[model samples]
Target: MSDLRDAAMSSKAWPFEEARRVLKRYQKQPPEKGYVLFQTGYGPSGLPHIGTFGEVARTTMVKRAFEVISDIPTKLISFSDDLDGMRKVPGNVPNAASLEEHLQKPLTAVPDPFGTHESFGHHNNAKLRSFLDTFGFEYEFISAKEFYESGQFDEILKRAVEKYDEIMAVMLKSLREERASTYSIFLPIHPETGRVLYVPMKNVDAENYTITFDDEEGKEWTIPVTGGNVKFQWKPDFGARWAALGVDFEMFGKDHSTNAPIYDQICRILGWRAPEHFTFELFLDENGQKISKTSGNGVSIDEWLTYASSESLAYFMYLKPKTAKRMHFDVIPKAVDEYHQQLRAYETQDTKARLNNPVFHIHGHNVPTSDMVVPFSMLLNMASVSSAEDKETLWGFIRRYASEASPENNPTLDDAVGFAVRYYHDFVKPAKTYRAPTDQEREALSDLATALSSEEAALAAIAAKNAKMGRDDPLPEADFSDPEFLQAIVFAIGKLKEFEPLRDWFTAIYEVLLGASQGPRFGGFIALYGVEETIALIESALAGEFTK
Candidate 1:
């Protein structure tokens, strides 16, 4: 047991810990469904956001960990509650005024305002599928409309009919009197109006699997619990779906944590043990407000992929699931760089160390090597200093730094180069503010420029001397692109000019040359941008060119 399996079993990583808990569940006997089922629920009231995709990504991580430690087969279901009634028309969607008439109808029943799909629910569900597919999530898609309408939920629906009073007794304890007075487990889909009627049921005929309820107009109607006649109210649906599918694990946002016991009790009443559940802290926008699709407060999943790889977004989701994350554009470059950092670290790790790595959970057994030569943050800084308008302009510098690299051979680097350009225009370009250097700063920068110019002159003399002796190889070029060498030169100048703490020197360099208050290491920037170019930039800043 001292091998990879032993390491996997003892790993303290969150996904492995969650998986071990599940593995303990079926230690005596495998599940009757022949596999452990992991389910993630989605509400199709609006287009899916980056946070929506995160739920599936996190669940997949746990599912892979479970596979590592247990022999039991596993399955994942990306469930959509499309039968949920549209309580209010969202202010963001097109033709929202036209959707008012359809309020209280199941999302699947309302006509799509977008003129795309047959119903609004389908439109949102399609978007959700596309978002998940973009990340290559392996799972089966189940729609609530299809599950209930096709009679797959009939058995559980009938079970709820038998246990209706018991379930309501548990639910009423959590609700205020105003809500408890009219709440019923069954919400009947109106046979005529096509709206989901929320009226209290007068009687539950468990023997016949039917419900009798009064509609809004005080009209009496008796409908079967089976088929498309009725759907469970959301809270009951939560547990009933768990019982119906024999789910072993599920996860949701922390907002649902309070209702977890109710879901468990109802599932028990329906003759199935509750699934193990995880409640992750809600994702937030830059302002710390909960991220929402309609509020449009954070970057959409597609929008994130616009300037970064899908893997970087997945890495962000993989980290600190129990803590709230601010999902904004500014987090992209850091996520990209950190993901590659992990990938590089993975190359040297042993079995035990690999088990705890996020990339292992993220990629499962199919982890791909990171081909990014330049860190993404460095690339963004490069974009700022170089003002690269196109990927081609950045590629020229990249090819110089990595002599053997090309777009075709280094696709990840190529993609990052393009991302840097787009990110610069959208974010950095808008926020940049330039200022002329202070008296001490200007003097120090001039000295640094002189130092580089002096080095260039000495190199020219050496090249001429070597030509006279026919040693035209030019003394092996001194590795001028090495960041440490360039950094040493900058450090020497900062000390000679007596800049307190030395960081002040770099700060002035950023503000004057890049028009930003902070930047990447000045030496590394020079290494990538070329020594001569940086000297010219320093000369340009001393003349107050950027301040103008």
Candidate 2:
């Protein structure tokens, strides 16, 4: 434990680095609240997106890292601002027009478009919980509606009333001069109608913990700040929530980087210290646009899981998080293969190196060994060649190469086979462009065919000679299954033909055979797809079977 803690103290992994910062918070003394708290805020205006899932996933990494470094009890809050007014209806939901009548009302007060939950907010909150729950995140869900109405935030709301000028002074400095005139710290909800009232306060009665305001109908009313009567504007809410929860750590996107100071100052003004803040760059789509839940330009959690494992998605989230990433369907195969590579590497890594390994943090001491007998990219290429329409068809080829492997014994690999078939049909098959091999490539490919034929004849001769000699010279175990041996054969052939830098030879194989511009190692492909089958494929390509 001491050794692990020491390693975490100096580890360069971002999670560990953030955990070290959290540890510094309590270095001088234990927390006043008796436990360190990590909070992630969610606005349930729309279904939870990948970026939302990322916050919980990434924060869990830091929290897990902190657990390794300290014995302090830790808590993570997945807080939802479900009480926030519906500023605009989301464009993607079913029956979008039905929500038009309810704009400006609290999300919890709006009718659900999906007809699943009590309100739109509940529907989305349920989704966010199910999304996090599906990935096995440990967190407590807190609804802003419940938090305020249940009087959990009563004291803080009153405090905001008492410190109105100090908090507003800090807030007004950030807003434009024209907008500052009408802005108030407290936004009240109508007593009769459910819509949130955005009018400026006529007068604030700090002693009574209430505010006087005029409704849109020009009616005067003063409401107590307690029992969900009022909620802070977003900027003030940020700091107030931090103060109320004593959140030790929270992470937000770089967009919020500018407003972090306002949150901190409000937290301090409300008589609580600010939490540690982590600013991660936003995720971008294929077109390099920031991923927005409303725009729907990026891949969703469901779309990613369609082609890869949840662990692979988590691995993608674990990578270079401070930098923006393109979360598209095309990146899934690479993520799946690389995640397994890291898992395999973790098996032999030392304690220091293991601490630095993502899998160590992903699975801790319970890392599962990868059951993938074939790489994912290879499976993708195999799917392309075989035109596999189902997992059963792909399994036939898989069993041919690995006679011992079955879906029962290799569930992970079996899943990849299914994903391969689907991904090929969806993305690869449609995009495949089979260009004819150039003159040089044709000559090289013909030479490859001649080389394989000669090699086969020579092997047959050796076997016959061995039989005549009465020597049982069995080949090495899993000889055909070895990727390196098969790759060596192809590499030797490429060198003999002298394909110049040699990538052109490989490219010829991919374009002429797989219809892809890139592919798995051809030697590895030959090993799994069978040497005779590959030889036949080469002949067919040379015969213009593909280009025709």
Candidate 3:
């Protein structure tokens, strides 16, 4: 078998193990058309947070694993329960004036306070889709609104009617155990109409909307109620949906572990198997608060993507074990670099012999090497500098530089190029800009300027000397570093620094370095951006006073 396949087979990732367990559990059962992997979450009443990505990303990982091992088709289902009533007005929703009226309406029908969409639910749902697509996640997205409108819940409702007493008792028991009380079972109430629209529960004889049971006193009484048709009442609902969909695996935050038994109960009720569960801890921000959109405390995937690539984002997600550990964005760059290094290591055919392997290194006697590569930001910066704006360029860099770079390098030359481009394009300060440089940053710049003076002078002398050489003559890399040429580079960088606000500084630097003012980073930016562009930008930055 190819090493990649071998590695995948030996993988310890949750997806792999959960998929195997699922396959074995159904090994002799009636053939299923396929397994469904579910990621369920409420639409953000506020901006969607990074935790939202955790649900989908982890589920997608398991889905891919099923495809890899079991030949069992896997469908990633993103269940957006927008039909659920709006509980609290999300901060992002502007104009909270009509919120009270919106309480009973399906979230999709609720008007956005911002007045940007037909309803607040519609606006938030769009943000969720946009966020998922930004990460290239493929899912069979289903809204509770559509499921209700389509009457998929008809059979479920009928079943609830037949088992009404039992289901209610179970739910009520679970609720009481959890120290909660409910006057009515949670049902999807049509936002437009205050009435509960019943989808007939299949195979159950429900008499009207009333169910009756004899109390301990033996006097039978009818209670006006909607069938406890919703997934699970109490906490077990999560498990019921899991079994209903044949989910092989699902993850939850640490807070949900107390309700784990609900999964078993739901499985028994449906006569379907339960999925393996992995409980990841809550993500925390730098300030030590648990990451949450409700609290306005956590960074969202949208925010992270502004500084990192989708792969890098995925890499970071996979860094910790999918159980009981929290992560912050500040530590993400390192994880991304490590993942890149691993990819590079996987590509090496003679990896065992290369003591100088850039992607991996021996840790101890008779020990296998571990992978470590440049950060994602570095690669991105490189792409930003180059004319090429695609993943292929970045991938090629990994393949080509598998023998030279190391993680110790803050941003390798390649990374510098990528980071420069990314910083310039995405976060570049425009108009009036104030860049407050830390003491360390200032020192680094001063050191770079001094180094540039000699490098420029040397390059200038070499260009003059090389002028006599034919265009076809072989160009030596060393010729670009003659002392006089190096000095000229120093002068240019120094001159460029005098330009006004940070925007002007970057513009002048790029124009001199790459002949493009509106492009990638300057120092590491040019070097990592693209080799060809780096050379071009060097020439440009050398030119005087960049302006329109």
Candidate 4:
């Protein structure tokens, strides 16, 4: 049988598979060290949506896989095209209506709403960096404003301009075919205030990054610089930069696949390598519509961190092939706790069975189990129990608790600490949610408790009888001794005559065992936690309350 690692590396799933094939071809000959793994982001015209992170996260997965299989180093670059002028204000941002006059300026030049940064773009960029960092994602980030203004890409731009006609023709044809937008064969260049005409491309004179456009007839011209004079049109600028950077691979949304082929043509004209492509699908909202910031129908990444950890978010995004479906927060957060549990289990000696599977090794390492630390819920629980005012004490308790959860193989204490810190700093206490027990729930808990108690007593009695006969059987006594406690719990549960659906039994059991009315499942937990602790836990839960 093939090893799990071999099975996982056998193929890269779509839409990345196409790109991976190209990478594989290159791997046969291998690209240079520091092979580029690029993921691009548009200007922060508004808060970034989860779809934005989805693109980068999937690309990161591909990059990680490539590194593991081929032993080539990758620099996953995240480019923020902040030089792209703000096309429109996103709906949810306050005071968006008043920013129309500033639309054409580079995003870096725009005013900051939070007053912490010089401009709105910088502020949002900071938030994005923080968000990605929290998720433990690593990348080399470049801002377009800095790239253009610092002249790091000057030579590339000159080459692009030298092949201006060829690049323009390619882009124009692509726009017509794909976007259906007509172009006038004129590149918009800044004109002097008194200039009545524009300079033709070849004749335009540029001095110290400033350029003046003169008409074909040499009648009128305009001088423009970063703030004033010149602007590269959308699709063309993207092509020129890719050519400059020598990018080996880049991923884009499915919507861009049409124009993307055209950009490759521009790369050919500019005498630079075009990146291999991976086209990901768009994320849809709960309503099943494409999430759009401009349309005012999207959830931001920040909004999602409230309910789940970043690892869960990343795991959820790539659990299936990236192109298979659209994702939303509601679905992702629901599975995170269980995912965390699985990760913890895999770390233990008992985990050899579970972690040995091929599916667990897909794309990247099964989220390091030893690193599966306590979540916000566990951290809060520890804090509630701690006597010291020290943050480290809370963190220490979390690490210990998480270690106990996976006794055989555990993630490092550092990972536990890191997760705990992020949870404490980033999460808000959830609003009080009390689900009243239903009659059905009462009867189920009561009946199960009663049956469990009877079984326990019967086993104990059998053990006692065997002991009197000098049989000394160890099994029955080992399994059951506290029949009375089980009966008490069942009776207590039976008192609440309400209709609780079978589906919600887990929550009811959690409530009963943990006092918060929810901790883990009842039956499975009872099996693992043992009947003695289960009874103690239940009695403590029913009487005092589950604190930690």
- The TM-scores, one per candidate, come to 0.94, 0.94, 0.61, 0.66
Model 3 — TM-score against the truth? 0.61
- State the TM-score for model 4: 0.66
lDDT (Cα, 0-100) at 142 in candidate 4: 87
Q: Write the per-residue lDDT of candidate 1 for residues 98-204, one digit (tens) a residue.
A: 99999999999888989999999999999999878877888999999999999999999988988888999999999999999999988999999999988898999
Candidate 2 lDDT over 235-341, as tens digits, reads 99999999899999999999999999999999999998898999998999999999887767788887888888989988888999889898778889999999999
Q: Write the per-residue lDDT of candidate 4 for residues 254-323, one digit (tens) a residue.
A: 7787888787877778777777777777777767788885665645676556545566666666655445
Model 3 whole-model lDDT (C-alpha atoms): 0.51
**Which ranges of candidate 2 are over 4 A from the true structure?**
454-481
Q: Which model is ahead, 1 or 3, in terms of TM-score? A: 1
**lDDT for predicted candidate 2 compared with the true structure:** 0.87
Alpha-carbon RMSD, each predicted model: 5.3, 4.6, 11.7, 8.2
The parts of candidate 1 lying over 4 Å away from their true place are: 456-478
Clashing pairs in 1: none
Worst 10 residues of 3 by lDDT: 356-365
Worst 10 residues of 4 by lDDT: 190-199
Comparison by lDDT, 3 against 4, better one: 4
